[model samples]
Target: MTGTHPVGTRAPGPAGQWLRNLTTPPRGAGEPPVRLLCFPHAAGGASAFRPWRGLLPPECDLWAVQYPGHEDRVGEPPATDLTRTARQAAIAAQWLADRPYLVFGHSMGALLAYETCRRLDHLGVTVPDRLFVSGSPPPHRVAAAPADTDSVPHRMHGYEHRTGTETGAGPDNEQHDEQYDDLAAKTLSADLRMLAGYRPGPAWRVPWPVTVIRAAQDPDLDAAAAAAWQDYAVDDVTLATVSGDHFVCFTRPHDTVRLITGAVRR
Candidate 1:
């Protein structure tokens, strides 16, 4: 009853309403469409997947998951716990009902997406038809991040690879503004803390097929690590390496979409 619509069609409200609205998937004219819900990487928003709409087949209903502490939801604090975050996502995605759907995520988003799928299983909600985890090590493979927060700002700065508006900067070098820096610092640290604290094990089981994707040039990803997805998926498992770095999904949208759409078609 209180959640914001993915496409701005409805205003968000309280918990009950939020849960109700969040479950619904955005509709397009047609028979029941296969929905593809995408989660963005850390410090990313739903807008990251907006361009994918054009690349997928008409049969696929593309939905992008939005996280707080970024973009329009800057006022809201980011949730750090995987369960809490996944619970909210499942509630919001409930609107899609029982239609066949796919879940795809990149980097930190990948772990979040997988955990959300697990949460859906716990709630006895319909599971996604497929899961595509890109540019991320398997949940169980990722160890806790070092307990250090002092260098978070420097890490954020480096992770950004840019200092301009496209990098979430405001005009006139607004990132230099004390307020923006403070906000960014807080949110960034909180997100990294969440990432660092995440713990996973082989006990998790996914009944559906899973596709693991990596970038050929991603130094952060080890091919051996990518291969570990085989331990989790109950059905088929696939490994694909495309040209680019860890953020290649956004960097190489054309190829990324090709990989995604191709997987969907299969």
Candidate 2:
């Protein structure tokens, strides 16, 4: 059944493809023992998970969900219907039917991960053995963001975390030109529209284990928001706390991968 969860962006394109960096060699031959699908946040692109290639666990092959209208797929129309995107993702993942796999999503991508899993099960394909949700509130909690045109910049800044392309000078970040800011505004404008129209259909659940991950310093998701996932989970959700802020996964890729691999294996 299509479901809802209390939980929880990017210029995400349509979902017919997966972005992968093959640097991490699989364990033995054809495919690894496990597969991990990484979904990105709003205004974010699959390139965000490129660095994770090296950090992949030996038994797992990492595949980042590639939304249309971004990077290499820039020619295609960007995906706006979240559910349809999830269904497409599920179909694209049919190849993983014979492999043990895990799914991970951050922020808005968390919702995508959950929905994609549901689609897989509905298709009688294969469901992930484990699903990890990070930095997102549950489905019922996601509501249309207020329409305050003046706050678009602030909201754009928020989505930048998902984009991992924060402007300005920093050790890990570099300065971008005014054009980048314009692009962000355009993207956020589209996101506001999506949020304004999006309505979570119903709560969804699965028999597989669901891990709710929260960053210790996340400003948007407090302990209560993180725990709300327990209500929608089919089984008692596993709550995990890790170091960093909302964009923790990108900031600490190694730690994030380590935590995921360790938790799933356990």
Give the TM-scores of the predictions, in the order they appear: 0.79, 0.79
lDDT of 2 by residue, 120-238 (tens): 98898877888899988887676643544564456447545454442342225544445555555555455445555556777776678988889898875789999998877788999
- Candidate 2 local distance difference test against the native: 0.67
lDDT of each: 0.67, 0.67
Question: After TM-score superposition, what is the CA distance of residue 104 in candidate 1 from its true location, in Å?
Answer: 0.6
**How many residue pairs in model 2 have overlapping backbones?**
24
Misplaced by over 4 Å in model 1 are 1-29, 144-182
Residue 5 CA displacement from its true place in model 2, Å? 35
Q: Candidate 2: where is the Cα deviation over 4 Å?
A: 1-31, 144-175, 264-266
lDDT of 1 by residue, 199-232 (tens): 7744577898888888898765779888888887
How big is the RMSD of model 2?
7.1
